[model samples]
Target: MSAGPSADDVPAPDPRLVADLRADLAAVGGDGYRVDAVTALLGLVADAALHREQPLAARRVVTAAVGAGDPLAALVGAFVLGLEVPSDVLATALPRCGLDGAGRLGLLEAVPGGRARARLELRPYAAVDAAGGADWWVASDLGETATGGPLRTDHVLGVGGASTTLARAVVREPVDRALDLGTGCGVQALHLRRHARSVVATDVSARALRVAALTLALDGGAGGDRPGEDGAAPGRGTVDLRRGSLLAPVAGEAFDLVVSNPPFVITPRTDGVPAYEYRDGGMVGDALVQHLVEDVGGVLAPGGTAQMLGNWEHRDGEPWTDRVGAWLDASGLDGWVVQRDLLDPAAYAETWVRDGGQREGAAFDALVGAWLDDLAGRRVDAVGLGLVVLRRPVDPSRPRLRRLEEVPGTGSGALGAHVADVLAAEEQLAGLDDAALARRHLVVAPDVTEERHARPGAADPEVVLLRQGGGFGRAVRVGTAVAGVVGACDGDLPLGVLVGAVAQLLGRPAEEVAAEVLPAARGLVADGLLRLA
Candidate 1:
């Protein structure tokens, strides 16, 4: 990967300092500095305000806590809140790693009046993966909130919305080998370690890899090939850091699982445009996303899975699915894409132009105009942003599952488990012939519910709906035939028997009713609305 002029001021990853910092943070981070504790201290209004980029309330709360000799308040103010703390107070906050270690790590900058300020963002991160809950301190380059200016063209992002979205969306099943492509600050790699026996984290920026190494080491996972188990994983492992762009670092090797939140943003290649490395892969338009969609299969072992978040253009005279479907047609893998949002050119331009801290002004308007011109040149109508799930089937003869649709509510539950179940069900359904499927017993998922809609005084329902209470929260309208077939699926009767009873009750041929309901049954099974008995 090309370095291409990024931030080089970050301190090199020092194993000793990282370990010392981890110990010191743990000493103070337990009850006082944890996510819950910090939330409690900040109160709901201030915490909510901080998320909205209004930090005045949080600053007030932390300022008072600091006066009360709260070490956590000192840590939060100096690092998270971007406030300068007295040197003595910071020293009290971190006794072991202390001020010297902080200086060596480039985490602190000396100010006048014996005060120190944070050069990096360090905060407690807590989340639940498929395995269980985790709490770890993450370090990354400070952002516009702290710097009070535009972001660097090659900023290494901390734990942000995009990172967490991909993290929660990733399939957390255990794997023998895994790869985290574009591992900025090693957030995804941190989760990968919990399930993968070996993890290869690669990045284009040497600075990013350096920070990633520090993050990995601080989590007590040693760098290199020696396998180690964390409390969160059944068989945790080592992280091997590599420097390269895209799939170059692991060219010949294939992994059982690969997760990437790549720099798939569509950006103009015009001279004046700042190509941020964290978002832009130095590629024009949406070609980076296209390249990843088509080429990621090369690194997947048989039956291996890959999950990615990407953006694709919806050109005029073309559907969004056709644009992404073409990529999957070229790839020899089963693909499922869920488009979460569709933004028009104007909205897209405004969102991205302001992403680099450009407020409404002449320069911001100019950049937005540039985005509009670049997009219009390609006849782009809108851009669809979504999650992409791909799997290289173990059996090459198996038919590919190429599904692209919009699911409203994702990231609301354990999506990893739901995806795993869906994949397994699809594979099982594939092996079952029509006759075999009829013989199989199925059960309605516990979260499944039925709703009926009709005219105010009508006896029969005009519309029947089957709704999923969890795992994507999908709702599908069904005919009475299909609805009856599903409602009787209590794992007590075979599917064919249920269809037969519904047909007999309606005075219709069993074959016709089965033909209508079977397809819907298969779909509901794959969507987690029904389960195999």
Candidate 2:
């Protein structure tokens, strides 16, 4: 048996090769090989199962298609399922690219028995980012499901949950320049291209850079051009690919927007631990996150922001906010951190062990044990995984948006817009005192709704909840008076008028009502339940 494909073998996509490949991929006759087409061929159940890495059902569907000589199935079999396809079938599938071009692109490697195996995993990826919707082909090193083995150490990843999370959470505001700190498979760079005039994508591994180049080229969508020396990378975008570890590639440079799905996974610093370059940052504990938190501001232009996903350790003596907040305070950047998940050491160990392809075996047990021991050594009881958004304050001495909290929920929508809204709101509120704020006309956000819960027989005796339809979908419980104040916020009157009205109706002192509801109003405004008219 010959060796399987490794990081050493990857696509070196040239403009000509990429054009031909893109054309064949977009060919008509039910062989177009797009996300919708592949899903229809595999059926919903098989397609969904494939996403969960249970490919037996998808394989069966593709096998039936192969028997019927379906060209799309052949492409899916070789690329998606990692199954060997007859060379002639592959040739037919990629007619314009042809077998030689695919081989030259390091996309297909010939095997014995007159078959060709896929060198990398390529599939249709669809996303709705801040700019708009796009459907494109993405390529990267095959995963455990496709390879049927442990991942390569330097494996480049395709679009996964974390990458998508970072993408959707990026503020869609157009900017002159943006930076993708670790551009694995170039996923963020593609999204950045939509709004950013130019993108600087940096990665530590040469292999990842190669995969990113190919993905950027082939995923250019319709009417997109290949990358050129003038920085016009494929997809009608400009990217300057750089090589180095976090922040090192573009040290002195500042960008209007900087995004990263960095190597923030905390790993055991043990000799036998197989560190994947895509996830592990080779740091002790959560130091990498701390490092990024403390230093990422350096690259942000004034009034610029950086968004990233990361993990932080929860120890016995240290509060996570203080632990992470110290970094923010020291860095002198406006920062907000939302802790989404807090998992115990054992659970965290099991998660990453399975992530590296160890399911249930002695090796998996050993890896988990190692991670647990490492955590124990540092007295780490829990781990926090969440989103980090930071900005370089226009004024270094006075910053407005320093916040840390637990917002555990599946985010409702593009969080970038929500984040941007909050930032703008904070800055606006900072300029106004409580008395001045009362004079401003405020309206309830369109998506905000009030839910009152009470016993059937009890009237006005229980709870009132203000629910947000978007953002983090937070439900804030309020008193009857606050609810009345919020319900009246329709942009028609100043908040002071609404407060006095509620006070009179409640038969309460105007000062007491103002003291109680005004603070609540401030909180609601920051949470996006209420907005300025």
Judging by TM-score against the true structure, name the best candidate: 2
Model 1 lDDT per residue over 122-199, tens place: 888998998788887787877766566677776778998888988888889889999999999888989998888788
Reference-based TM-score, model 1: 0.94
lDDT per residue as tens, model 2, 371-486: 99999998999999999999998986664578999999768878889889988888888777889989999999988988988899887759899999988888999998899999
* Alpha-carbon local distance difference test for all models: 0.83, 0.86
Task: Give me the runs in candidate 2 sitting further than 4 Å from their true place.
Answer: 1-8, 28-31, 221-226, 229-232
State model 2's lDDT: 0.86
| Per-candidate RMSD, Å | 3.3, 1.8
Which residue pairs collide, candidate 2? 227-233, 227-234
- The TM-scores of all predictions, comma-separated, are 0.94, 0.97
